[model samples]
Target: MKKINLNSEIEELNPEELDHIEQALLSRAQTISKLAYAPYSNFNVGAAVLLENGEVLQSSNQENVSYPVGTCAERILLGYAGANYPNSTPVMLAIVAQRAGEETWASVSPCGMCRQAINETENRYQRPITILILCANGNVLRVKGISALLPLKFDDLNS
Candidate 1:
């Protein structure tokens, strides 16, 4: 048997390293976290998607009485982007979360479903989606693509 190695780099965000657009995307995610409708869990999550065309869209988690009916911020943002800007490729994604009564915001990683959704988008658009996770520690985690987050991802049976 051959050995396989999977490696991913998670870097702390350096203010000087980020460009204007990256900074703005992170800020949008932080701002949207305040508006999440999470009455049940009180864990508000926010996400921002930056399109290849330079358009940035933000969304907050929407909770529902039926837990399964609710959606995550990442899915909401991606769904909206796919619906409205079908032709545009997603350039980057940023995520942040905060508790209902908490002043500190934490970096929330994408759920398994969201990771697959992101992988689908990347394969469909033929572009890598950079991900920025804003942490409560006042640092950000930077990842280049979905593969970094979800190694050995599920590909179709045809593959």
Candidate 2:
């Protein structure tokens, strides 16, 4: 089997030098954090995606009384993007999280489920999506594509 080292493919980008599409998503992600319904976790998360057509979409995590029902900000944004714009593919996504009532940013790693969801989209579209996660002190944890995070993933070839 051919092994793909995905991180090698992840392009490290300076926040200041991000492309216009990336900037749009980052701006929207920050704003969407305010709309997060994360009363349970108290850790609000926001995610934004830039579509091929240049439309920016964002969403915040929605918590539920039954914890199992809660959805992550990344999946929420992607789901909506898929539903609203069925024909379009997401080109990039940026994620950020904040403590309740705090403006300080924290790292937003993709949950296992979020990773799987992202994998599906990437596989479906056959396109690598750039993911940016804000880190402390103005640094960014950037992953160029979903493939690296979930290496040896199950795909059509496996079946």
Q: Best-fitting candidate, measured by lDDT?
A: 1
Where is the poorest 10-residue window by lDDT in model 2? 4-13
lDDT of 2 by residue, 1-159 (tens): 997644445555568877676677777888898899988889988999989887888899999989999999999888899899978899889998888977688777898889889998998788988898877565666787877677766667657
- Cα lDDT tens digits, model 1, 1-159, are 999999987778766678888889989998998999999999999899999888999999999999999999999899899999999999999999999998988657899989999998888898889999887787788899899889988868698
How many steric clashes between backbone atoms does each model show? Answer: 0, 0
Best-performing candidate as measured by TM-score: 1
What C-alpha root-mean-square deviation, in Å, does candidate 1 show against the real structure? Answer: 1.4
What lDDT score goes with residue 12 in model 2? 57
- Cα RMSD to native, each candidate? 1.4, 2.8
Model 2: residues >4 Å from true position, as ranges?
1-14
lDDT of 1: 0.90
